[model samples]
Target: MTTATTASDDVRLSAREAAERHLRALVGRDDAVLREDQWAAIEALAVDRRRALVVQRTGWGKSAVYFVATKLLREGGAGPTVIVSPLLALMRNQIAAAERAGIRAVTINSTNIDQWQPIHDQIHAGEVDVLLVSPERLNNPGFRDEVLPRLAATCGLLVVDEAHCISDWGHDFRPDYRRLRTLLAELPTGIPVLATTATANQRVTDDVAEQLGVHADGTSDAAVLVQRGTLDRESLRLGVVQLKTPEQRLAWLADHLAEQPGSGIVYCLTVAATQEVAGYLRDRGLEVAAYSGQTEADERHALEQALVEGRVKALVATSALGMGFDATLGFVINLGAPSSPVAYYQQVGRAGRGTDDATVVLLPQAEDRDIWAYFASLGFPREEQVRETLAALAESDRPLSTATLETRVELGRNRLESMLKVLDVDGAVQRVQGGWVSTGRPWTYDAERYARVAEAREREQQAMLGYLRTTECRMRYLREQLDDVGPDGRAADCGRCDNCGGVTLSSAVSDASVAEAGQRLSRPGVVLEPRRMWPTALGNLGLDLKGKIAAGAGPGRTVARLTDLGHGQALRQLFREDTPDGPVPPGLAQAVMDVMKDWSSQWSSRPDAIVVVESATRPTLVNDLAEGLSRVMQVPVVGTWAIRDPSVPPRAGASNSAQRVAAVRRRGGLDADVPPGATVLLVDDQVATGWTLTVAAVAIREAGAGAVLPLALATQG
Candidate 1:
């Protein structure tokens, strides 16, 4: 790509020359040559008024784009540059860089609330050139009521960093992002707005535009410069291992650590998991640290320092480690499957920062299959959920606590929170003093009008899920999802995915070849319930199962009984209701009650089990039930289902059975064929949904599985 050249190429030095001059003047180095692509991006910024989104991989000098823009704005006598950044660390880094370049930049955040008054005065006094503030800081009343208004009067330019936060589809959502639209509204018109992110899909692009009040029609005078660069790191080798046991996974990690020594990340799903794994790794003689949301700010800072200073070889962390830190981490091991591809991409993107070859190993626990299945089944939040959440926020008076907001909206808390935060970053809602409040009016378009747009967003999410479930061309899948067209006119087939190994496995089915190759696997049991049978079951059982589960419940103590389990008899007698046919199984209703109580106990004890469902049915139903249960129970449902093949000799409804099993496997991650000695269970909405049960039984038998039990809501058969 040729470097971008200004219209006045003769008078205006090329972007490269400008960059070199600035670098030489600032760092006393003239050898710094701007990359052709970086120069193109910088040059485009000079004249382009359309909001531009610069997407460059890490270490690609993304900051230089802004640096060049800053210089241009300053030279042109544009108003003082105001940067909205997500992280205090990033703000500090930028401020330091600017200071080193002899530019007067000031950062406002929590730590320097006292210094902010002077800084604010200086900004209005025209002493400060660049002002860096966190999204949260912008939401402050003082800033909003006093400082921001003053700054707006003398506006230079506004830049939003990590701008993907504006997309509800982005992995990391910040509530402050929603206020940007209001902030922009207050700014003088014609001031350039530049949004930068290393990762953003079309969904992100639309969200950014929407947040900035840019229309989808592309008629806005504001320039929309999108530079989609190659995120491919040929030096990075991606490997995924499916492990049945935690021990085996840890062993593999240890072996990998020993083989390749350098800075690395062992990413876990939870804070406790990070601590446990970090401790274990440390015990195994590996120098390690832990990072998670629960880690104290001081402690996290120390840990980061340790990593940067080479005092630690590895850090076991939750997703919290990926965003702000700028270390050249060598490897990243996913101890569990990330909730989404965006997460996986962000986590893995942290590695190979220095351009040298690195590795990203995904050690997906067998249990992770269910997590992936749950994600696949639900796909992404329905457009209704996103719309509803945004609508609720738009209607609210002040920022409401998540609990308070949940009572008003019909969505799972976590899912809702994630969505709200995304909208928040997108400038739909602002985080107020104690809670989240609407930044502006609700979307005014009729639901029917945006239905297609919503569907497109859903398709994009599904595409990402498909990439996760894919066994072929992981890189190709990623490139396709990003809509990246490489030079070859074909999707770049990253040589690292399982498919490129000459191994072809259907994502719809587990990679049996790999599974059978002695890679330990964890195959969840199938439950005898409609994949989405939670609502009906909850209603029929006359129990708020979600409530109990959230209170705390243990898996071992929770038992669901059918009509054959005897409790059904008592339930029918107590309620004087007719039994649904067949033999009223002994202890069924009582077993279900016990399961409900136990589930509650488990939830209280371990939040991870807070969202447990008694049955897993069809994909759509499963998604509905899970969403309902998550909202009602205030916990995310770990969906369970049974799997069976429809193509057996004695098969009745063979095709339906095969389709159900396929669907369940595609969504819930359980298979009929479990390894020998594996403890398995059959879960279903009703025993009449026996196709999945039969398949599960046959496959378990074939695999020499041990102790397969049936867990069902009803048995009409």
Candidate 2:
């Protein structure tokens, strides 16, 4: 609540006027004026040289505050502004906006690694006024060791975009963002800093503001300005559609997507669902494209442009398209519910940015909780795994790369890397040139804190479910979830939601459309690409495997991915621990046969024999699959590989590739003799890491099989 002491009244007013002029230039409108709070924020940063956090709605001109402050500060002889952004899409949009305002802006991100050196040169040469870098770049060994120190010392203003990610309590917490505390500690005392986010609740807001208030000497100033506005989006009309099945949901979209006012986004919970929904919509003669983290960078850019320019009807996407993607999208439809209401609010905020009224609808399906549970399994690892990682790092004479560390720990590559980032931020480890090194600093496990976070996440999930069935005002519920307190200390109801008697979406869908959707979804198969190379550093695990693997298995086929919209439901039910072991059901049997009928045509040679990978959990299902395929394809059942040991507990899962491979090699071997150079069919009930199939195929090939055409009932996409 303290004002900047250095700026007098007249000087602050003059700076405020200059900021408005900059805003007018940026928006290309002479009449454009800064909102009261925006001016207050810019005044604090530009004139007062103090830290501030702006928690405003998505379209409330938070970017304008920073851009204007950057311009005014640079004019007063401050150095270039360093903005730590989260997404490439956001960086692109900011660069474009900076150009429109005649401010020189450049970016350093994964997509433009070749341009980073020149960008750094421009910043050093005083030619660039603004620099945008991803938070992940803050931990890069070269950047952290070489460029970041200079940037921190010389940057005029530090802007943290999407700052909610810096808080572990936030819905979309990122480990790399924890590095911000280190960066903050390096900044000079009087250098201005601005952190902006549209999605932070009270807890996230307080967390970020506390970090912002820290000084170079490790003391908190308590003078950081926190300006939080209402979280309501006036142009969004919210509603929900409760559907019984995935087929009916797709039918609803197929029936109603084109009817939306303008081009928009259709969101799904999983990548496989994105592809499935986009493909089905396109087959229904709608113009759309599937977008996710798995999409190529070039294609993502093209698809984004298509949506912005109204070239495509919509982009069926996952959370990949969530933060800071700017478009005048007229509608946003969710194929499934997100696990957290805060995250849901952020995604839906992408729409109605430039429109009078945007359609926002949630189509909640029956399988959403299952998807939530699957994602929950990927949260923070157990304490033993973290201890093991630290122990390995402490024992190594030299820094071990993530791949090398993976060979020592039982964690997967992604999860292990994430845990290391958090530890680095906590002073338990440090990232050096080659890899990570133990800092020898004492650190607590913080089991109670982790438990509290888990409890919070559970509450958020249950609240999201309640959202689907709530009778109160939908918009008010969302705002309250974000802790948005208005001037009256309460979130008021918007008269536009379905529960509030606004424009209600039709619940009726054509019988023909539903039938078509069901038929299309029932047709299930996913092409499984074969692993061409073995995981690195297998020698550490007493295996000689490395380098490009010899071709033991060709491309394979699975009935469906567990994330798919069609037979995925059935597969999920069948794989549940409570589900009893039995033969393959009639519907799934037909699906497997159908997959075989289509997949066999793509093979170079038909299989002469079938080999089953024994499943300890579902032996009957795997045996029945092998026998049925043997009868149908006229291929003999030649062998069985007991990869799943009964004595070894499955409590600790094998998500890591090297771990799975080592376990399979220990217990798996072909038992039946094979004809030399004869084609073989490998059957399994499910393919998770795919190591069982790969290892089994290698052993079968060593047994003199010509080619392995592996088939599975489902895949864990």
Candidate 3:
């Protein structure tokens, strides 16, 4: 194939026929034929060998185009196609789909580490027709320096699935996806490239198309073919159910989940919520399972299989189950709304892929905004943090691991790592074997660009809220958010949606169901796991602490996590920044008493004394909690800690292990006199880092306490 290849008499007819054959084989239906748009994309990639961007709705045969193109290219004696997929779930589904077409596809991802070398060998030996890799793999040191160069030179076609992630303007922007620009630029001339996404607004579409045409040498390439299609999904019936409380929402789900058409997903905003919701639903006799990023790889696979086979009613999940999770889900219920419409569209798109009339419902609660804000806060850190990180790497003679870097900087591990990835893509840093090292290249923080992105995020959030309140066609509003107008470029209604069809989900949930939900949520206690080992590389921070912690506080219990469904909702109100610090509330105190009552049954020994940790914030709450526990347990409030350096307050969740430990140590010592070998109950209003409680427990133990049993009103874990 040459760069000038395009629609021609001989090439057009031959490519179209081959694409149809591949399409039919993949779909397992003799009647399967390429849509006009699908054929256009395949013609561009296979017949013309030109870069193309296909922006279509979910279930619009985007994958068919790429797979058929890969087949046609390989049949023409081209090299194996290389696809950069965003999620392992997507890669897994793609691999299976390619098999249906008799394409010898192989994948390299974070999972299946032991098979990497063999997979690479298969590609080299021409035994593989397609290679699917996560975008993160593209920038990996070994893969980037070795494997990528070879793949770029020899790959017949380059495909980017979920391509919207490459644009910062995209709802689910991923820093790693930006690395595709390098891959695109390095590919030999005349190699065809295809970028596909089901959820990109016009802004994201244009941004991706521009990037697709850019070469590595900061120059533009030939025009890229852009295939845009309608975003409406006929199978989806969109509706929003406004609920007042978490209990009400849970009650609605419990009452109506079984009424939905088929097995589907119940999307929650947090991992903790998924567990809580799934457990509640299971108790109500629903065959549901909780899934999140924390779920083990093997278990996630099993859960996914169960969902696919209709063995479970639904999976209460976070966005971990989003993006390319293929199932003919009959319905999708959101326990909470996504922060933006684009993300919301992508998620709900998972439903109704292979079935008609899939129910898409959104249950929006007041706390959804609060959840959105919490996630929004995790965006790009302040300029000072970037400077500190760069300085740390620049000053080091050798590569410093993230743990060591954490000692010098205060950002949390996840945030730190995310920043490093962005910096690496920007040429300010490079990931070496040890960890990360600063490149000598000059870099500047693009405050203006970041500000614009933030503003866009805010607008999207507001639009999501508007969607909930709009009386117009729900599908139309969502499509408009994605800049998807019909062929006429005019707004049109999807006649099947709840709004357009005048269909409403019954808002009435039985009071008994609500009460039961409240009861389940109200019964709160979460295991407070004790730290078994000191954080890695604590010595770098001048702390003597290292390795296993010596006989530290035993496992304890907390009333609830600040993110839990039941008492957690109430705790959030109590801990809001604007909320005045005061004595513990009646409900929280009752929950704490309940937890203590249940915990004492399993304790090896009963506590004889209670100790409260000093809290610069919520001191009154801590003292009150300690006093109440002391009164209930018939123990004395024997001791409390003092703040030695009030000027330097504890930075709760901002610090890493070393910084947290050091901060806690800087606080004044406990002043209690404990009888030798006496058990002590450690009390605190909340356990954020858990370091504060740990440091206090150590002090109590040194003061003659035999064992420390930590208890808190809530945990932030």
Candidate 4:
């Protein structure tokens, strides 16, 4: 025992000296020093070989601690460190930092599949010091079964970056992150593990710490030593601007973006808003571009660089820019409020990192609540759906692809994919190249647990509402929401925010700006691309549908998208279930007529007649629209297609294109007696899959119609 203690003390002294050297190199300064807590974490990992959790705020040098410890461990003849990073952007940043310290780091992710072999070779040669991978890669069947076991046996250190994602209690819970437990259980004895995050609250911190499991002393109660610090940003001056309408918000943003701090981000709640805002800003002569999930990866990288170099004034973005993004951004302007205070804080943290003073402003709008509810609806699957999926996979003789299973399931493709990921983590199923197969493991549907999470989400949203209504210091309210009441002796008010500092931000917008913004928002019409081909996979379900649709719905137009910030609100209310179906509203009728007149050139000829696609839920709305168009054009209302079987359950709202087409076929075909080679206009209340219009147009074309023109008030999901 005495000999072991002496040896450990010697290792500790050497580790500290090595840590300081690496820290200096890492920071690119000879006199640089590590924080007391940073050094403590390094000691725990490099000397004691203990598990640790560091929950410090951003810009707190969490990555430095890991890199320094890794250098020490590798020098002591330990294998390379393995880090599970949450984002590609984060990995990019980490790799550059590691190289600065003269530590060799390599990453394996989807983007560099071809280079993975060379990276693996380097690790086998002991030429690599660190290996970073995203959580999703851990579930790769080949890697999990073969390569991961070898890494587990020889890896010197295991690091989980943005580790809060591991816990469902976390603001962002990724199913793939939860799979880390399997990796944890398989690690060789005496290997130190580290988990780091800047945004986890007390609940998330404790949860992640427990998962890290007992320290090097063989202590079992808490496996990791968790070190937390205050979530205060002294440089951030937080404020809020209340806008009565979307136009007002856009106007304010246009009027003030140039006057705000340096290059920054303008966050929108949706992709549509980003496009709209970015367009308006560009029209205002501000250099800006839309950045969202739809932006190409290469362009996104360029945009990130642009912001870093202050080449672009701002990049209007969505939550896609919420995490993983690293910038010394000078300001952050939120066009809409996030659903939770934690999410808000996480986003704002991206700014004020490099400067002494940066602006963080929130422009809250009532529409934000509707957007929140739309996202909230996509929560966990029901027990029936889970059991159905499991039973389908278990009963199959061979692996069934997602496309094949779609025929037997009711959920949409995206939702099904998300559920499969969760189930894959739970060991209920396995995803192979051909498709997925059941693991034959028994699984329980945790209804109560999911319900608790739902309730928690509701509570968080309410807290956000509370934040918007609070009169105290804006920064303090946010900190308290994260349960970050700082040190016991810390000041209650941050004194940097609008409230505590007694500074008032104006909501004034110049008349010229308001008119410009109003015209931009009210500008109508969205190109509706016709369905060129039937959605693939219909034949897999035994339907004779594949390849280019020989007969297709042509290019069309929608007055607006349901997600549009302009006139979509009125269109949505008109289609709501509570709003009884009736004749077209006079204003909507006028708008439709105006749009048609503007699109007259697109049509080959005027309509000889108007044909309405039947709607069980809104029969009156469709019929009224058809009749109104006919009356305005002085054409006859030819006929309406009726659903063949009232007993058949509702199918108009089917999720996928293929299924939606099948449902329309089952409902009934078009019922029209048409003269050969006569032009007819087809009208529907809304276009979703566009399958309805395609099917109707096919029937009409087969009946010898010269052209079928499709029109609708809105395009929806």
Candidate 5:
């Protein structure tokens, strides 16, 4: 994290200047256009010979730095510069840029494999200048056996782009990057190696260098370039919105689009959710496109073209669309909280590239709260997990199924898979024929040293995660991590995050009040009595009803009458008639009525039916009421229902009579035939943050349901 130290006194022109003058003359350049800082970094790279890790933030022009180093060594009569990039599109872009700069560059990828032989011949003949290859392409035996040997014979400059992939701590870790160290070992010493990434922090930089075998004492003289004092476009305003329902979220997005009609991307957590959101947007009269891993290449290309041509104003996507696809997007909206800070930054960076002003909006859900909590609980996977994952992968001779690993390791399937992917990127294992296999080498300085380093790296990752979950200035955190503290010793307030804007709920109130309110409304015995008075006992008490009321079922069904105020003529009438054993006490009815009224006003903006139960009420009152309402209203419930306390755990021969009836009601029961193109209604007992309903709605749409509506007894605002 240390900044580059400067010389105390400048020497006018020394022996080094004379040698540089000669070298520049041979390279056909009169002067090095690189800034002093860049030149110092380049000189360090040239002197150090080992791999150089450069952690430069956005707009620092990392590509230019590496290009200059490549030219210096290649033009100085060294070997052809070999650059391993991550994406084929990026390879093409870099090669095109190089060619435009009048530098000879060639790329070997899927499309132009036919030209690979000629490129190989040129490199071996020492006629090629810079050779760009995808990591996947580098793993090809044809290139490894033939072209690599020639390149090794005349080793010059080796450059790795998206170098963070070499570290387990990186967001976009790739397995191909792990084999890079072994590949480099095949070449001779004295060949200067450079690794460049825009997002790597100190931990990532150190791990990447170690993985590449660039550090001898596990210490690297890596330089971190912080793009401090730059304004992130005045046009771009970051905002966060808290929503309680899927319908509200959709309506909000529609309003947002109406206000700003431009190209944008909506990032979702899952492919299925992306598709659902895209459909919902389209239905709402917006030109929308969707992309995910499951999407066909041609379809994705067409979507991309549509967005670029202004034919589609919005795109819903998973993270399948990666770092290098440069689009002139107007906004980037995250539908749920990102799992990591690096992911959040990368996705948000997609917007505001060309627009005068753009926006990055985060719509967090309750499910995402679990995601953060899970991350907090595990923090980062411990060193033991890493070692176990590696040892298991090494033991497997073939590409091991993630499910198998999960069973054996006793780790959650998703977590285990993520860790395995990280290990694969660090070069400890490879996805073999059918399972993971050992790469026959450890990532760092044996087991003990690696364990220590792994523990330290985990702590850093946990700290970063905590920072991301904070409601503070994100830009300030970035600056602090890069060691560029402000003059006032305090980062500038962003005035955007949930914390700064005072949008977050107080811990005490959010934890106790919302849950208690939701519980009162959704409780099994809760009943709503009709009210016909304004400013009555319930109204005077300032109660709001927020949960569902269960009514009895039979030929003459009991009603759960909703009221603005629970204490009124309706409650008095019900007590006087229904409770005949004694003269119904006014005080008790008024108190219960007050709670009901408060719950209703707090939940539903409008009043409706009062929940009146017959003499009999079942254990699953909520489910029964939901089923009865769906039948009565003839609306299909789009998701599954849970009976909180089943009489008995479902046995092999037990009949699902309740389930059958519910399914019948869901498909439009005997009461009414299924309406043509009727929208589906998803019913739930209670909602904390509406994430379950959102997911259920998406599933309904995917199942060919015409429209989806969520019906719940209670919800958290």
Candidate 6:
């Protein structure tokens, strides 16, 4: 057997032919052949051993190029390929495809802990051909410092899937993906590397291409970027509906989900939307399931399988199921428009892959930017916050867990973790065995760069808005947004979209279905699960509260989550920062009545008395709540939980459990005596951590109340 080592395309005709044969077997078809560009990538990676980035459209055979290349290289006695994929769904689909081609593939991810050792043993024995890992896996101290270095040096081909995430200026900015730079530097020279993504604007393409360069002391080696595919999915018919309200959107799905060709996806902008829309669909007799990052791993797998097998009408999901779910979906409808055109293009790409004539609809909403703003508000915190974090970690001799850091800083837990990851990439901090440790590296804070990224995001928002209102072809608009040019410099209208076809999509859903949807969403109340266990490491904050909260801190009811579909919008308006801290108006009081009435059956017993928590900012609201309950439930307003320090207001409901517990403990007390064995209803404007209600219940229990039920206007986490 003879092998050609040069990457010259003309020198590897035999190998490329064999690669096409393997591709046919992989796709399970008798007449499958590689497109010209697919063979080009394989030629570069397998024969030339040159670094490359392939910016092809979804379903453009990018994976086929890598798989065929891996097979050919391994046949020539090369080492295994290492692919860093972003999502578990993508990994599962890729593994199945690898098996069809008789390639031994295995994965290392957070979900499959039990199989990691066995998989590692197989790799050590040289029995595996390809390995898939998530970007977060690169941050695992054990794997990064130990296993990754070995894999980098020996792997025949390195693949970065969804490489758009590697760019900070991109819409989907994942801080962990930046960790790829370390692995890029670790790979030996001439070890072929492939970076592939479906959604990258010209700026992102240039940035990722530059980053993928095999730099040696601030220089680069030759690299090829194959970006030939036009971003048009010819099988799609795109349309947008500007709905007046969330209920109308849900009504549209309820009325027409079954009208979609087959099992598909109904994407929601938030978990709240997913839950609300999925529940409404189920009520209307659609076999729909909700999937989100918050869903348990086992349940998420079950939902994905259900959708794949066509057992459900649709999966109501967030971006959790977005990256690479391989079902050949027949349709995809968004509850609201995604903030970025590039992100929207990537998501809609999930449909129309293996089928003809798939429907893609965007229900652009008035509240879309409101939801986007909610996320942006939590983006990269101020420079002072970063400095405080570094100072906290640097001053400590031992590694500090995130819980410990929360005591020293006011940042939310999620935001704090995000900052840590970004700082880790910047070399100022590192995740170690116990937690995080400062590396003492002098890091310069680039405020200008962050501002530029933020401005880029705003531009993306505007572009997405343009997509909704554009009179041109929807496919052409998205393709141009991604900077994808065809064999001609610009692509033409496909004559398939609603605009090009001159057809107005029907928003004329049945009136009866719309009424039912409105009823479902308007009916309020989300069960407020009580805090069972106390937050860990409260002792670090000088509060020794630990273990489970007391029994009196039982399950309760809230009118709505501040992010819910029903009264949430109204309550949010009332809770707006500029809203006057006044008494609850009669209308909102009635809304509370509706929630309590619906929740009447869930409570074991009615309250014997009402207790209000003293709110320094909303005293009138608290007083009104107590008084209104006294008139409605015929229970006396017994007392208020007094604040020890009136100047220290309660933290937002989104605060970490540790800080909320500490704050509550610091200012906690029951001012009035309670009747022994009396049931109490604790009233407040909202519950975020549930600690406020839990601590109040404890004080009431100490005063001899037998039962406590927390009732609040809103709840959040």
Which one is best on lDDT?
A: 2
What is the per-residue lDDT of model 4 for residues 379-445, given as tens digits with 9 covering 90 to 100?
Answer: 7778898888898899999998777677667667877877888898788998876789999998888
- How high is each candidate's TM-score? 0.61, 0.98, 0.98, 0.94, 0.55, 0.95
lDDT of model number 6: 0.84
Please list the residue runs of candidate 5 whose C-alpha ends up more than 4 Å from where it truly belongs after superposition.
1-51, 109-118, 125-128, 137-155, 184-187, 209-236, 305-311, 354-356, 370-474, 477-484, 487-490, 494-717
Model 3 CA lDDT for position 445: 96
Candidate 1, residues 239-318, lDDT tens digits: the string is 66665555556656655575553787888866645665676667668898888877877787788878877788888888
What are the Cα lDDT values of the candidates? 0.57, 0.89, 0.88, 0.83, 0.52, 0.84
Alpha-carbon RMSD, each predicted model = 14.5, 1.5, 1.6, 2.9, 15.9, 2.7
Which residue pairs in model 4 clash with each other?
A: 213-223, 214-223
- Report residue 3 deviation for candidate 5 (angstroms): 21
Backbone clashes (count) for model 1: 68
The segments of candidate 3 whose C-alpha lies over 4 angstroms from its true place after superposition are 486-490
Q: What TM-score quantifies how close candidate 3 is to the native fold?
A: 0.98
| Candidate 1 all-Cα RMSD | 14.5
How far in Å is the alpha carbon of 390 misplaced in model 5?
Answer: 8.7
What local lDDT does model 4 show for residue 603? 80
